[model samples]
Target: MQLIKIDKTQNYIINTGTIAGDMEGTSGGPTNPGPLSIYLEEGRIAAITGTKDDPYRFKQPNRQTTFLDLGSLTILPPLADCHVHLALDGLDFATARRRWEQPGELHTQISTQLWDTVRHGILAVRDGGDRPGIALRYRELVASGELTGPVIRASGWALRKPRKYGSFLGRGVPAEMLDSALGQLARHGVDQIKVLVSGVVSFKEYSRVGPVQYTYEELSAIVQGARNLGLGVMAHASSDEAVALAVKAGVNTVEHGYFLSRDTLKLMAEKQVAWIPTVVPVAAQLTSLHPAPNQDNYVIAKTVDRQLAMINEARNLGVTLGVGTDSGASGVRHGYSYRQELALYRQAGLTPEEIIRCATINSARVLGLNWGRIAPGNPAAMIAVSGDPLGDINNLRNIEYVFQPV
Candidate 1:
């Protein structure tokens, strides 16, 4: 369990019998681990050969190459988090509702959080919502090689109806101005558009979600405008009506479908719209207030149970599910929440392979990144855990190595 450093153009061979990527052989069971010699060229997986094949040779001239023999450790495509808040510190959500006042302090905390996230094996992250300029800077830093972190696909603050929803991580705009709002996000270099179709689920009130923020037509305009700008729209929706409207509007992903019915799940599947049922945020509450549950914690515990049931139902319908931790929310730490979401997915009847797909490949597709696969042409981003995650998904928590742009 030590960190290794190498130059940019230096070639390397990672020797591991366990390779998991490209969504291969993952069908609700542990994939058979075999000998794989992952050969790298210019920081990408140039070739992956098994025992029968000759050690993959790079067909071109190469520099000094080193060999890493990680005999039986599990190697997986670096994970992705489909929804997160880079602005929040995950210290009691009720207290830290607003973005930081000091710009310098915010940058320090967020930079550290991003560092922690990448070090923990997350290679790509879709920031669902965050303060303006904060996520943008990290995106720049990652792209420019000034820092290392998961490829950030930030929404750059969400668009919500003014005067009704609180403005903590996003701005409040009128529904009629949805088109303009999408344009603004695109101009901000957002990789995707986040629309607050409804408020977050209320842990305090039973079956209560925040107020609906956008109408179907309004959401349609937002989605259309975002699409025109070549940006995918991620809808923050929890209520059935909100989820339905967002789906009808053709948003790329639904953030929180906590109360969605099986019918709605079918509709989402039929339309090929991805769903990111953020569990750990509320689960964090449950973790904190268990054994002596308050009304809010009780409601959250019940909601998590229902969410798991719905997630199982979603799987049966062949719905595309992306893993989201809603990190930066109370009790959900950065980097750690990825595995928390995976463990919850396992609890929801998903096998280790299925949870890996949800956290890595499925979420990567939602983020539109050229990742989630350990193929020859893909970026050499991956993580090595101490044990076989395919045997027990919880073993993902034991990250031994994280390979990114280092």
Candidate 2:
């Protein structure tokens, strides 16, 4: 088991026991009927050949090709985390925030988390914005090879209302200064626009979330402004009212859509808006290493159950779902918490295939990438797991190799 950075200039042929295709319109079965010989050229999948037709044809060693024969490993599209806060370390928030003043310490912390994230088979992550634009800075570093990490789609700084829930996450954009604020963010070269539609959900109070921060008009203006700049909006919305507002306003994705009603889910389906139900962050509160004494465990557990039920309902109603561990939030660690998020999806009654689809395909779509599939012309960014992920979703945790293109 190793993490291999693929050299695009070199040719390689990997022979694997099974190769799973994207779970799009049909069943998520292996692309080939039997053992597969996959050809990679210049960082793209050149071809896929099944050994059932001619086993010995590609088995012969050649000088020009780097051959790898994975006996039992299964290859599939690499995973993605749609909503993460790279500035937070899932530990003490006070300590992590204080390090923000020290650039050297902050970079060191973020570098370590990025490696942990990629090692867990997550190749891409969408940073859920930080106030100081720390994640945005790291995105450039990763691009220039100064920092080693996943593909980061960063929201430079989130837009929020004055005295709202997300002071630490981003700047407060007043209604009058909305255009000026967006201009500043666009000039900063943000990959997307993050708007705090509502505040955080409550831990002690069941079914209680913070008030919606933006009116429908304000939110719609933000969404349209972002679109004019060629960016998508990832709305930080909770409760049903906020979720509905974001959907009607044309947000690309809704993060932590807790307490969503059936009608809202139906509306999301109708509008084709993706939902990133960050269940792990809430679930982690109940079992955190450093738990808050004032938190109510029963209330948090019930809240988690309700969210999972909504996730199930969202899938049933054909709402696009993506896997997002609110990493850096209290009790949710990067890289490691991804498996926990998928497990929650399973508890929501999603089968292994469905969970994989959300974690890979749907998440990749949210990140504006053409990945999450292995075929001719697709980028050779895939992962090999020790066991069949289709059989048991936990097998994704056993990442044998990460086939990352250089």
Candidate 3:
């Protein structure tokens, strides 16, 4: 085992132990003043203890092979983006899918996006949904290390009502065929299931004031079916009723909850449901000029105001917010949008630490991953930035370095 000892006077001591996944957080702070002893035995921490008399007394067999003087690095847990769409940027949907269909083009596209995200300090990502098999393929590439990017967990295609809501971005199976559709996705090894319950207010044709795609029964069926397969479900909801239905159906996380009512937010807190409020898409819609019918000036202005109000309300109600960006959507660029999300979160009243938590641990928890924390034994997935994120959350936008399990 290899051990690295970080003795921060009284704040904390990180002892990298032998066990591959051993991690410990102590409240007593660092060990007595000494040359923070570090030992390595078989690529894992053998033992780390602080004592003025003999810091290396706990050392086992092997000698220290590498040493990096941690005189200036502020170590913290890696970050995760809970909701992202790998294939949807400002680029057209047909073009993105066409790129994916080409041999190696999909890998290239995902690799670029993933690395871009990593450079921005995101180490783990949970893709909400995309066209069939796109996310699955990217997951394999990332897991295999054939691609250098964030650790990825993905849903197959999103489930949308035929010819409505996310139909263009997902598989639109008839209500009666949802069970079979879910089964097919499970067979394809999707990590989770994504369901589109409502339209977005920013998209004029599919505004929140219009009817939702799935009836409560349909939504319930999708949730129950996905649960039966031991898979979690993430719902794309933008209206009050849509959020309520998704929460009642027990979807693990609500994506883009743009129009959640107070009652729905309360239900989420009560049910312990998580939220991935992707404000980037709405923000982009409000600020960009893409010439789409959905981007009508007046409509965008109204949508932005309403969405911001809803977000503020959700935050006030203490929803378990996770960071996410509909990155692949028009005007929502990949790496930059995450920064936008963090800023938006702050604007919604979250402090720097709270926003970081939302981006890292909360997002990881939403995706059911155990690698968000930076302690002994956790996967060595982490990043290093220039300034203190505690003082300025925007420091995350200026990430200087990244370290993954390469």
TM-score per candidate, in order? 0.93, 0.96, 0.84
**Which candidate has the highest TM-score of all?**
2
For every model in order, what is the number of clashing pairs? 0, 0, 19
Global CA lDDT of candidate 2, please? 0.89
Q: Rank the candidates by lDDT, best first.
A: 2, 1, 3
Q: Give lDDT per model, in order.
A: 0.80, 0.89, 0.68
Over 4 Å off in model 1, which ranges? 1-8, 26-32, 92-99, 289-295
Please give, for residues 1-406, the per-residue lDDT of candidate 1 as tens digits.
3444334678889888677675755433334366778888887888888888888776655588888998888788888888888878776554444436767766777788888887778878888786464776678888787776778888888888886564776777887667777777778788888878888787777779888887777888888888899988888888888898899999999998889988899999999999999998888777664322344667888999999999999999999999888888778888877777888889999988788888888888898977777777887778888787877888888888887745
Error of 3 at 360 (Å): 1.0
| lDDT of candidate 2 over 1-406, digit per residue (tens) | 4887777667788888877765774534534444788888777787787765543332324436688988878888999999999999998899999999998899889999999999999999999999999999999998887877899999988999999999889998899899889989999999999999999888888888888998999999999998999989999998889999999999999999999899999999999999999999999988887888779999999999999999999989999999999999999999999999999999999999899889888899899888888777899899998877898999998898998887
Candidates' RMSD to native: 2.6, 2.3, 5.8
- In candidate 1 the C-alpha lDDT for residue 168 amounts to 74
Candidate achieving the largest lDDT: 2
Please report the TM-score between candidate 1 and the true structure.
0.93
lDDT of the structure predicted as candidate 3:
0.68
The TM-score that candidate 2 achieves is 0.96
Q: Per-residue lDDT for 1-406 in model 3, tens only?
A: 1122222111222332111111122433311222343333333333344434354432332333444444433445567788778876555656776876675776667777877777777777888777655767878877776776777788878888777867546887898899899999999898899888887665663344545888878888888899899998988887788888889978988988776778898889889888887877777766676656635666666665666676667677777888888788777776778898888777777777677677776787887866655544555555555456767888766554454554
For model 2, the stretches where C-alpha displacement exceeds 4 angstroms are 25-33, 52-64
